[model samples]
Each structure stands twice: as C-alpha cells, then as structure tokens.
Target: MDSISQLPDALLLGVLSLLPAKDVVATMILSKRWQFLWMFVPKLIYDDNYQNIEFERLSRFVYRSLLLHEAPVIETLHFIIRPKSNVVDIGVWTRTAVKRCVRELIIEMDCSSSSTAPVMLPRSLYSGCSILVKLKLKKVVLVDVTSPFSFPSLKELSLKSVKYPDEEFVQSLLSNCPVLESLVVKQCPNDNATIFTVKNSSLKSLVLENQDLRYNDIGAGYVIDAPSLEKFKIRDLHEDRFCVIENEMPNIVEADIDVAYGHPGKILSSITSVKHLTLCITSSKDAYPVGLAFCSLVYLEIWTLDTEWSNDLNLLMCVLRDSPNLRALKLEQLDCDGDRSCWMEPSSAPECVIWSLETLELVDYEGAEEEKKVIAFILRNANCLKKATISTESTDPNKRLEMLKELELFPRRSPNCQLAFYYSP
Candidate 1:
C-alpha cells in the first residue's frame, strides 16, 4: 500500500477508471492521495445490481458524483436502471452526462419485472449530444422530437427491445446519423415499426433479430439498403416474416442467414460477394437463387435442423456447387434425436469438394449409417482435403471405437488427408 501510494496520480486514476463507480468512490477512504482521485476517472459505470443501496440513495450518489467529477471529458457513461425506478431522476442524470461531453453513453433498464413502464429519455439527450460517438439504449421509450436533431459524430447505435414513436421515426433516426458505421436492432412485439427499413450508406456491419411472434402474419418485414456493409446477420425463425434487400452488398465479406422464410432467393442473391457464410434454413426448396454463385466464398458453415437429412444434404450440395473457391466447411447438427434419415449420394461431386476444400468438420455426429455414408462420400471426393474431424454425440466407449474404426477404413481421395474423431459428451 505504501509503494502504490507513491505512484503518480495519473497512474492511480488509470487504475480507478477500470473499477465501477461504487468502488471508485469507495477508494476515497483509503488515504489522502486517493480522496480526490475518483473525481478524475473518465469512465463511470453505475449499475444498481452491484450494491444493495436503496433507489433514493443510489440516485443521490449518482447526482453527487457527477457534480463532483472533475474530468475534462467523460469517455463513457453507462447506467443500468432497475425496474420501478424513477424516470425523472434518470432524465437529470442523462442530461448531466450529456453536459459532460460523454463520447459513449449506454442506458439499459431492467424489464424483467413488468411492474413499470419503459423510461422515456430526456429530450435534451436527443438535441444536445452532438459529439456522442456511440449510443446504446435498451428497454426504453424514444419520444418524438419536433426540433432538429442529429448525432453528427455517432458511429455505433444499438436499440434492443426499444419502443419507437412510429415507423417514420425509426427511418428518420437512422437517416440522421450521417457517418454511422454499425447498427443493431432487436425487435419486440409492437415496436411501432411494421416495416423496419435501414438505408445507410456508411454502415459496415448490421444485425437484425426479429422476435415478434405475434405479428408474423401481418406482412411485417425488413428492408435493408446498406451498400457498404461488410458483415451482415439476420435471424428470423418465425413463419412468414420477409426481408427485402434494396441493393446487392458488393463489399460484404461475412454473412449469417438463419431464417425459416419460404422464399430466400433475393436474400441469398444479394450476399454472393461474401467470403465467409453461415447458412441455416428450415426448408430446401427455393431457399436461394437457382444459379447464384458465391465466387469469393472461402469458408462455409451450415447448421442442420432436426428435419430430414435429405433436405439438409440437398441444400448443402446446392451451396457447394456454387462455392467453387470454398476451402473450409463445417456442418453442425442441432440435435441427435429422431430416426436417422437415409443418405443418397448425388450423381456428381461438387467442384469445391473435388478441388478446393481443404478442411471438413462434422459436429454432433451420431455415427449412424446415413452419417457414415455422408462422411465416406466427402472423403472419397475431396481430393485436396487435409484434415477431417468428426465430433460424436455419443460418449459410450464401445460406440466411439466402433465409429472411429469405421471412419478410418473409409477410402480417402487425398493421400495426405488425416481423419480425427472425438466424443463431444
């Protein structure tokens, strides 16, 4: 303690910055050197769950700490409010943070207990925070602002289970961020946006998750028009939910498409430029464009559902036929239940399997006859394969040894290909 106390004030403050607000303030009682060090910590995180303080006391501490904080710039201000907390006090705290020139601000309300309504953020936060770089709000209500508003320097924005005023507000808010780079929106029921549209030119990554189970039949959908997107992810397993890409993402390098929609032809066609793709679908028929070619694809991951293995294999073959440059392939089955589906080999091998594929992984392998046949087909066709790994779902030693011996006996087209096996359980 004596040696640490002799360190420079800057070093001490740096250490304090990593601690939460409660702990930072508690350090004042250590010694005279630490009495005022907490005041200069640039980042403050106030989470009610950390301490057992009453709501009123927590509010007072936050108000007092912000008042005494002497930092020149608040690099980050994070607040996690509990259910049934006072909204008026939260507004004041946010306004104070905005006044302190906070670069990154996060306000998340606990919505687990449905006893309180979503907190409506202060209007000053909308118009005053011009220099904010990143803003994330969860389980809050965004009120409409009649005055001019824009986050000129904001780059990353995430809205998780947030309530917007209307659909126009959603589009307007996104359009106002001129230089935004990343956006994540997790939708909930009655998010006030029937058709969520994102039309940003500067965005490089986008993630959209639709959890609105009650509104699938109402024609609710998404429209994305981000031309510069490099990474894209969408997960909508609900039935009948649709997505429309306004333009092809020529710059996309990675993509994850997990959907149960009947027609995904348009979605698959727009991401052909992707180099790494993760695909999950419930049906195989018309899941993607008939002739769509992923010319730049180097890595592919396919997630198999509990449905028929034939449908999954058909989709796998279709994708492999188009991805001629794919070097690595991973197949993961979600479960090991139900009767094994019969495996029927295609008349011809995919170009990727014959030439480009180097690595193959089979996850949750049940060692059934159908699985063995599928593995044998790949081993026989993949001439350039270097390594193949099979992770079995069974933990029985006899079954595992039997499976390993059977796999080892399969003929490998590539003389150098190494076969590895393991029990996952």
Candidate 2:
C-alpha cells in the first residue's frame, strides 16, 4: 500500500474532514480501510445543487450518512438544500445533529419558489443544543417559544430571509443569546414583521438590510438600543416610515447608512462617535439634522441622489463643517441629469476644507459648470491637500481631454498636490 493509504486512522480522518459529506461517503469505494475512516470525521457539509441526482435518492443518502457517522461530537453541520427538499427529512437531520452535540449549525435554504411553507426547526435546537456557538438560518420560520430558552454559548447569529412569528419572538430570541456579539438580519417585505427592535447590550456589530419597500409611505421601522455596538450598518432600499436609535453608542467605530427616503437625522445622530462613516442619501430635499458634530470622524464618504447637487448642498456643507479632523473626503453623484444652474457656494469654507483635508475623491464627474466650480473651490482653499482623483462617466477621448484641461487650469492652494483622472468607458 502507498504511504498515504497506510496513514494512521486519526490522520486519515483529518483528511476526510475537509471533503463534502457526499465525497466523504464515496470513499467507501476506495478500500475497506478507507470506508469507515470517513465516519470519524468531525464536520459534515451537504449541498444539493446537483443536477443528475433525484431528490428521493439524495434524501436517502443524507439520512444514511448521518446514521453511519461515528463521530462522538460533531463540530460543524452545514446544509444548503433547495426549497423543493422534503421538510420532514430536514427536521430529522437537524435533530440528529443536535443529538450529536453540533457546535456550529448553518442552514441555507432557497425560498424563491414561495410555494412551500418555511421549514420549522425542531424544538430540541433551542432547549438541548447547549454547545452551539454559531447559528445561521436562511428562509426559516421561527415559531413562538412557549417555554423559556437561552443560548449561553452562542456568539454569532445570522438570520437572512427569515420569517418571525411575531415581534416578541424576535426579542426573546435576541435576549436569550447572552454572549452574541455579531447579529445580521436581511429581511424582506414578506417577512410579516414590520418592526424589529434589537436591544442587546452584548452585541458589538449589527446589520439590518430591508429590501423592496412595498409602498411609498410604508410605516416600517427599526429600533436599535445596543450600547456596546462598535460597527453598525443599515440599508433601506425603498421608502420606510422611520428608524429610531434609542441609545447613543459611545464605542461606535464604523457606520454605513443608506436610506433611499426617510428621516436622515435618526441615523446621523446615532453615529457621532464613529471614526469612519459612509452616507448614501436619496431625498427630494436636504434632510440632515443641524448642530451634529462628528468629533471622531477621520474618513467620510457621501453619496447624493440629487441630479442638480443643490438639494443636499447645505447638508454637505454642514457635514464638512462638523468633521473638523477629517483626513479623507469622497463625493459621488448618484443621479447626474440636470444642469449646473443650481450650484451655489457656502457662505464660508469649513476648517477641514482649508487645513485638515488631505485626499479628495470624486466619482461620476460630468465636467458641468457647478462641478468645475466645486473642484476649483476645493483646490483653491485646501492648503494641506496632497492628492485629488476625479473619475468621470464620459467615455469619449476628446471629452476626457477637454475636462482634464479645464480642471488643470484651476489654481492649487497646495504646491504638493497631485491630480489624477479616470474615465469610465
């Protein structure tokens, strides 16, 4: 026998641990010794994105594999099953994994069909899986818990396309995770719950992404009250009524907010302590709250949907004025359509614009009169500026050259500043 085939049982099992559950089971054909070596592997991953195999055969194979595995404590159990999979088999498989003391469980189920009801996890998962440290479920329905439950060891929990029984169940689920530090929820319009309030003190990172705003004035909202949160991100693709940040996060280091239409103040006010911030706002008029100061901000990126750039010009000026210690600035125009007739300079330049700003980046630069004026204004005032990069959407070589010439003629306040241009074809 070869040296590899003659390896020790423990080493052989270690090799098999990296293979998918299907491939591990196929090792039965290699040799008698290799047949049961895979049974001792600690991690089992099953993915049913195959084309030739029939669903009935796949189901039987999964059940047989689970029954034959000889591992004492399963470290990881992952299943990526299609929506057409049998719910009863999934439940049985999950129960078996829980019985074997699974430490990490991930289930990604496709629910695009919408014809099948969301799969209900076994109750044993909540009450019995004491060793679980990470749990991620997609397109699963979480039923209301009648009895008390807690995941004492869970540290990471992600629910995407998940349907909750009610608002109370979600609260109960989060409250039970004593050590959970990272939580992610990507909810859709059909998720049934219009409002989700996360109020965990132990959470450090939170992400809330809501898609497909049903109506222009849908009364959807989120309430976050995590005091220890350090990284926060929220994206509402369409219009929502409002978002409430009940507690001011003192330890927030990073925040990324994108709201198509809503009260922008609720988001800006919550991240005053953040060092890195990205704001993507789309409103008919400027909506940023006044007197907000980003005392800790060092990097700032702004994306506006105003075609004229005048709708949010005042808000932009306020942000520049508030971030006195900012070192980098990035501006991108989302919907560049109208003329530059609406552009007007602020009464006075911000302190950061004159002294602290070092790097400036502009995207979707169309070489309009207002864009030229803004570029000139920054180059003429920013004494500490080191580099400025401008990327335009125009593909024509002649237009790019013309825009570059126009920008090069603008006077520079800092002799050390370098200019760079990029053209998107």
In order, what is each prediction's RMSD in angstroms? 1.6, 2.4
The residue pairs that clash in candidate 1, if any, are none
The worst-scoring run of ten residues by lDDT in candidate 2 lies at: 211-220
**Model 1 agreement with the true structure over 1-425: per-residue lDDT tens digits:** 87999999889888887888999999999999889989999889998777667889899999999999999888899999986789999989999999998999999987767664788898888888888999999988898989978999999999998899999999889999999999999988877987999999999999999856665746888999999999999999776879999997999999999888888768999999999999888776657578899999999999967467776777888899999999999998844457756667899999999999999999998776677777899999999999999998786899889888889999999999999898887
Clashes of each: 0, 0
lDDT per residue as tens, model 2, 307-358: 5577666667788999999989998874556563476888778999998999
TM-score of every model? Answer: 0.96, 0.92
Please tell me which predicted candidate would have the highest TM-score against the true structure.
1
Q: Name the lDDT of candidate 2.
A: 0.83
Q: Considering only N, C-alpha and C atoms within 3 Å, which residue pairs clash in candidate 2? A: none
Please, what is the whole-model Cα lDDT of each candidate in the order they appear? Answer: 0.88, 0.83
Looking at model 1, residue 309 earns an lDDT score of 70
Best by lDDT: 1
